[model samples]
Target: MNFERAIIIREKTRLEQLIERFNSKAQAKFYIERSGGDFNFYEIENEKFYESLNEVQKSISKHLKLKIIYRSFLPTYIFTENDLIVVLGQDGLVANTAKYVNGFPILGVNPDTERYDGILLKHTPSDMNNLIKEVVKGVFETKKVTMAKAELNDGQTLLAFNDFYIGADSHISSRYEIEFKGKKEKQSSSGIIVSTGAGSTGWLSSIFNMSHNIYGFNTIGENEHQSQINWEDEKLIFVVREPFLSKVTQTDIGFGVITKRQTLKIESNMPRKGIIFSDGIESDFLNFNSGSKVEIGIAEEKANLII
Candidate 1:
């Protein structure tokens, strides 16, 4: 496959967002300093990001036609097979870009090594030139990561690179009917989190941490076992958050594994405020109100990250 263009994906720096909100850089600085915040920190972060972004553009331009796009436009952006994706930001940016690319090879570039852990960002700006060349030659390696999918009965769907949160938008309890492996129950709880193998260490691991800290929690053994899932594993793990047991509800069917052969089904009972969001981006969500049923399973498509 001959790649013809490199699409650079980025997000606005914190300083930029602040400036937009305050109407000017000076005003933004004043607001932050007045609030005891380090105004210089935001300035430095913005400077370093643009500096790294400029270096990436220069290097990629030597190999393919380069185009820059803000992360906000990703939903409406049309990508072609001839495009190579270059994502510059923290690890979350890579996760945000993966679902929209349809398995296109993504090179994650860590703009600020000091600030971000960059678990998903394997390359730096200096590595772009050589990496782009290898990708264009089709000689590069990619780690195929499994993703989770939520398909509603009405045919609406959402993909999650890390995990999907199915519950109320607010802090109130979410009421739903959950079914897995022939067992079904009606419950009221915080929500349900369905995570892919790549997402095992993220929101899913935090749940395990909480469970570990709680004494006499028998679920610690199961949490430890599920946390070791690999990124390439074609499976998903679903856990019910704080499943409350009452005379009218059951908590027996709260946790399970999802696969090609098995799936977790959920039907919302909330009259309003029910939603399903993926990868921590609540803005891009599916309305999961009453009468909406969704099947949570392993997505057929995967995220192909350039390694």
Candidate 2:
């Protein structure tokens, strides 16, 4: 196994400790970044985080020869060569796991064990030292995850670690007609969601009115109203256990499902005002006036995860 390119991804507070622990055993590097930007709130200042990172870098430079990098965004750099990676924070773990899928075994260290849902990491900060020792001793396992891919009408393609969403923009309703394999269905509701196995827990689960599963989709309509459904056995099944009625027409809202082989199409009158979000992060708004078509499908490339 190659041990010269060991990379450690962690938060500011735990950088020094991780570096000191792994530097002697393997060639190690560190990455640090500020948290809390996705929800439009700033948790830490850039200058403050960078200043602390610089101090940590200097301390590590005194004892080891390695590079210290900064991660400013999610889905950090892709893996080019085989290496042992030690991740130290929740965001770092999520970002690194989403980006690096090339059969590298990752050891996740939970800096804050009690606060967040560290289900993926599942290891305490105190366990970092032991985890590194185990990693060097070849004592661990890795898991694989699937990714959803989206291809637009313009031949542009994108990937999602969790799910791909096509829906109305914030505060605006969307009206579209759907076509599946030459069969047309007019949908005057919100939008559609296509998810992979890893994304089956969140939106998809809620839409189907069931617990987390392997693969599914969720279509959320306007005004917090939704019609949950799933595809199975060459047919789509809609769950109407707790049925809902449309407020505008007072008609029982129905769920929908389309076969996998069917070519599903969604065209909106307000396509420009509508939007498409992937994995709750990446997004692109459509322009109906320009007459663009948004196409989505299962991706050929799947994500590899170390669970």
| Backbone clashes counted, model 1 | 0
**Candidate 2 lDDT over residue span 169-267, tens digit each:** 654555555555565544545456665555555566676555222233344434334333221122222222222235432223334443345434656
Q: Which pairs of residues collide in model 2?
A: 272-286, 272-287, 272-288
* Model 1 spans with C-alpha error above 4 angstroms: 216-226
Taken over the whole model, the C-alpha lDDT of each candidate is 0.92, 0.48
Return the TM-score for each candidate structure: 0.97, 0.58
Clash totals in order: 0, 3
Q: Which candidate number maximizes TM-score?
A: 1
The list of candidate 2 runs beyond 4 A from truth reads: 1-3, 8-78, 85-87, 91-107, 134-139, 208-263, 282-290
Best by lDDT: 1
